[model samples]
Target chain A: MAGTDKQQDMLAEGPAIILVEPQLGENIGMVARAMANFGLAELRLVAPRDGWPNEKARASASRADHVIDAATVYETPSEAVADLNFVLATTARPRDNFKPVRGPVEAASDLRSRFAGGQKTGIMFGRERWGLTNEEVALADEIVTFPVNPAFASLNIAQAVLLMSYEWIKTGDQAVTPPEQALAPAQKLHIESLMGYLDNVLDERGYFRTEDKKPKMMENLRALFTRPGFTVEELAVLRGVLTSLEKFSPRNPRGSGAPER
Target chain B: MAGTDKQQDMLAEGPAIILVEPQLGENIGMVARAMANFGLAELRLVAPRDGWPNEKARASASRADHVIDAATVYETPSEAVADLNFVLATTARPRDNFKPVRGPVEAASDLRSRFAGGQKTGIMFGRERWGLTNEEVALADEIVTFPVNPAFASLNIAQAVLLMSYEWIKTGDQAVTPPEQALAPAQKLHIESLMGYLDNVLDERGYFRTEDKKPKMMENLRALFTRPGFTVEELAVLRGVLTSLEKFSPRNPRGSGAPER
Candidate 1:
């Protein structure tokens, strides 16, 4: 059921994943698997070193034969992307060009918006050892790259496919999230009541060192409680914590306040 | 330089990546490569399928010897993540529980914020086939999952690592971007000048058929131009387009406007 064409429509259709001069068939197979995971079915290969119809790619593609079977081959990168209205070339290295260079997230939004307008889009991935040449990148509308450790910037071709494909499905998404984790924000009146209780306890415990500094310290405490607006549950837990501390106060010692049961 | 310890510090240190009862050594190797690409060095393995000191994993790990050689093996999943203060379990399948299940991007933010607070964190990936047991997920503080086609939601162990590692580096990033591609916005006066020129040309071209609807049409045009303010270069191009179109106007024939080219 997962391999059928009918079920493939469950995920949104996305930009093409094009590979230019990919050397190894195993890498091609891995790229197919990556695309399948992200709901991207269209795969384009240009001047593959091992050529099309190779058995190695078939063996490595796991069960994602649909992407590999429908994969198209073209003579040049230009001919491969000629039908695409917009093309973004992926390169690991920075280039000296005026074309917009965006990270994966921003580029995903650009592709998604263009998709909404009914425009066809494609992202080009260059060769394994030698990435896209300047001439080939010139054919693209923009440049899109990845985020890797500058110390070890290398990303295998299959890994690069996974990153871009993952972004293609994630950007511009409005999917339902898991069950709500946060409760409603605490009301100002409720928070002020808790603050007053805390202030009274702190005064009883001699937490205020100086009379002149009391107002400034209280102002800081108020800001901390109101800064980002904690959830009602969070506020409740905080109040309970202060109430627990009040029982341990020296003025009302917990060990002496209650006799041994 | 890219592989040395001194160079590793170029990227910020992130959470440990823990694999629980992984089945394949090659998959383990690929995970190391993915983590190294994103500047994460800590790796912990819990009861690997073939036990410790496996040759297949080493062969698959590329040249990320720092991560592969230093990996520590533990007896159980609990022992593997015992030292970490915050833990996230990665799973493709959902469970009927209250644990917050976050998408990769949001989970990345959660991890990074805790990182800012100096709390140690780790993310656990389960067996290649079975994924995490409910009991194993119970050990984690939250759950993190990927964006994949629900029809074909399977992600190979290595591919899953690549997606999470990519997000680990991207979230909360303050890295330098490539040279800016956009020019400054056009001054309001300059934009209005081009708008006037465009109105004149459209009037000469009889673009407005009804006088009553003209105001609404022009109002739409004004909003279109100002809604997302165009840049100076954009305004210049718009004016030039109108100037070029003015020549072909039927009212002012370019055929007899001046000398022929």
Candidate 2:
């Protein structure tokens, strides 16, 4: 169960994302999956060109059944945001209008405040080939755009949704630290003890020659063992290997290669 | 020309995203789209379940035609990332090993620094249903996992790619500002003139009656005009509306209901 809960928290609610004239069902499905990744639900489709409930889209959604099931259909962009008090339209190009424009971060902050004040807000995404029309953009209070590379700014519908959703989740206070480490790491002392045992065995074997250089040789040996920062299990395995090799030493009193004990 | 320039940036070189045994062509295409969104260009597929040259994948890629076009296929994940100096393996469940585990932000930062040092790097994503195997995870220098909800930590393939790609772009030094405004905003004097014209029309219409309430009413009117933070074009539209209403007045000798030349 601890494995399952690693830094995972309950899902959060977010504004509806309305996709207008989306061309592919696969894009629709991927958008749903992207939204779910950031704990967002409530998807709106405004007259998809290929229509809704396509098998290809459903298959592509992977495991996000709830999003696909709860997705709502609308006849127009205005109809999609009819019940919302505020709306933001996503565009790649800056519009020639006076509406306040915001990058994804600012837009996400504004959406968070609006949601906190008990306002129904939604984001409208235009068609895949061409984004929202001027008439459609006029319906929104603000425009949200990505600060993308000027030389290559074409972002698919799902990528756009993912960026916004990621920012929204990041704004909220969630414990982003990895889940409590699954296993307790072995301490330095544990490795030191293992090193001491191995050193004694090596001393008997004449592995450390030149009495004057013994200290430096021991230090080098310790460094090698500590480099990978072995876990307790790894240390145990190394101890087993050493004991087994000592048994086959022929230095043992037993005529056979087994340890006398 | 700017619109066309958008799709032409020499794709920002980043880590190779190797998909090990990806099942569907649709998932592969979506992954390519996600990679392109943030300038990541290298895609290596290892023994895909559905084989190569998938039509579904090509179609789903949308405008990431280049990514899919240059995608390379490999016999295994090891082969895919063999040429890179460093590799990262993604896994949903925590492994019982001593490998350093990083969240997306830290991983992106590390990848950025490594790229700066002229080292080739890559990240491996596992199959659709079950993630990377233990042996495969063992081949990496580090592991990265999303801090998703414990109850539902499953993120589809494309979503995983999107998250990593988003972080990669975010950590870079590129100017993340929106392009220059298409139309420079109107000066304060323009809005002031429009506000003055509207006030005169309202006074003539007897909308601001009680003298004591005039100042408060006027202050409220000014606040309303500035609330949406109108652009110059918006002010022009408001001024046009006021002139149109003043036309039916019989107060104007301009029979055309238009302002005098």
Candidate 3:
């Protein structure tokens, strides 16, 4: 069995990627790489110009060689998407012969629900020169396109695939309930307390000379410290340094006063 | 008498930054930098923090020293806005106390229109620690807040300043106009046509064939040419080489078939 087939069997739910009349082997490789980024393994190629199993495609796949090795090649789009229950076609230019067009987010959400119900879903991408032809687009249930800068909307093939993959991953079941043991950064309250202690120490040492402006001065200090979003361990270290400074300072009643100025 | 004064004088209308009880010199300096980014020069400090004109503040101001030099110091929020006809306070937390509330875009547009009508408008940013005290928020004619990440809305002082400044600049007369006379790239259409001709000639000569699927041999050739969004000049040089290749080929109709290989 091919590596991609093994990967697909292992997954609880994941979508298939279909490339129709993909002219370049490198682009096919890049699409596989993008698919791997979002954990999608199955890749179906329809009538590639360079033939199947090109070395250039393997090299471009990089860490995703498994995806390239397992890619299935077919003579036409119909054969490629024959098994898919739901399919989405991606294109930049709007077609006059339209199906219901959904943005990336909506398409991802619908696909997620469909996958949850144990239905197979696939997304089709067309050639770089001329995107999916009108006939090819008509085969899909829905059309997908990115909300890009209107004047510069010509996206590289891999970039378009990556965006769609990202949205799908975000909407997937695995994303909803993230792992319980996942570590998050220290909370805001802990950082606030550390800042308060540091300001109090500074105040005790006569660092804040102007009494009327001390409140405003402390606020600015808080802003600077809070911006970095320090962790508990980092805050503890900073507090320790402040404590040591207080003990060593000449202003301390127990320490030597203004030595060798 | 300073650079900021000259800038303010040059612009018949400009946005005023009212910083309420700002605590740190560094943050004040950073706020100045943010203001300068959006062409906002006037800075009003209400009870600033390490006292007015601290050396640390000036150092933090970096290239925005003019904003620091031109800043006006006031003791209270009311005192800060007494001279301004329109005042907008920036706050994150919503309060029950009644006041006209506007989001960043609306607030920026309101300020722009007010300025155009010769009304002096000031935007108030509260102290970082507690934000604007309820009493301080009450002092303003309107309140403005940003549409930030709801889960983590704790924006840095300078970041907040930059966002507001960006909106204000975008809405104001200082908006960047689209460039006139769209200039095409150096290479023109003729060069591209030549490159296409070369590609066809190379294909006919079987330059891309290797120990692979001969039927789909054109894929790798398409990949190379698809890249390098080339101009007309580059294509001409490539075409010249193809012409030389055709002349040298032993299969040329006018020449004796000499096996060059």
lDDT for each residue of candidate 1 in A1-261, tens digit (9 for 90 to 100):
234577765663778889999999999999988888888888899999988988899899887787888889999886787667667889897676546788988888767776765657789999989888875665566788887888877798888888888888886473423323444345445556666887898877688888887865665565556544465678888987877676655665565666222
- Which prediction has more favorable TM-score, 1 or 3? 1
Q: What C-alpha lDDT, on a 0 to 100 scale, does residue B25 get in candidate 2?
A: 94
lDDT of each: 0.76, 0.73, 0.65
Q: Which residue runs of candidate 3 sit more than 4 Å off their true CA positions? A: A1-261, B5-13, B173-261
Q: For candidate 3, lDDT tens digit of each residue in B53-102?
A: 87777876656666788899988876777666556778886665556678
Docking class of 1: medium
Residue-by-residue lDDT tens digits, candidate 3, A166-197: 56765754443322242232444555566568
State the displacement of the C-alpha of residue B61, model 3, in Å, after optimal TM-score superposition: 1.8
lDDT of 1: 0.76
- Kindly report the docking quality category of candidate 3: incorrect
**Once model 3 is optimally superposed onto the true structure by TM-score, how far is the C-alpha of residue B80 displaced, in angstroms?**
0.8
Question: Which 10-residue window of candidate 3 chain A scores lowest in summed lDDT?
Answer: A176-185
- What's the TM-score of every candidate structure? 0.65, 0.58, 0.35
Residue-level error in angstroms, candidate 3, position A165: 20
- Could you tell me how far off, in angstroms, the CA of residue A179 lies in candidate 2 after the best superposition? 30
Candidate 3 chain A TM is: 0.63
Ranking by DockQ: 1, 2, 3
Error of 3 at A54 (Å): 41
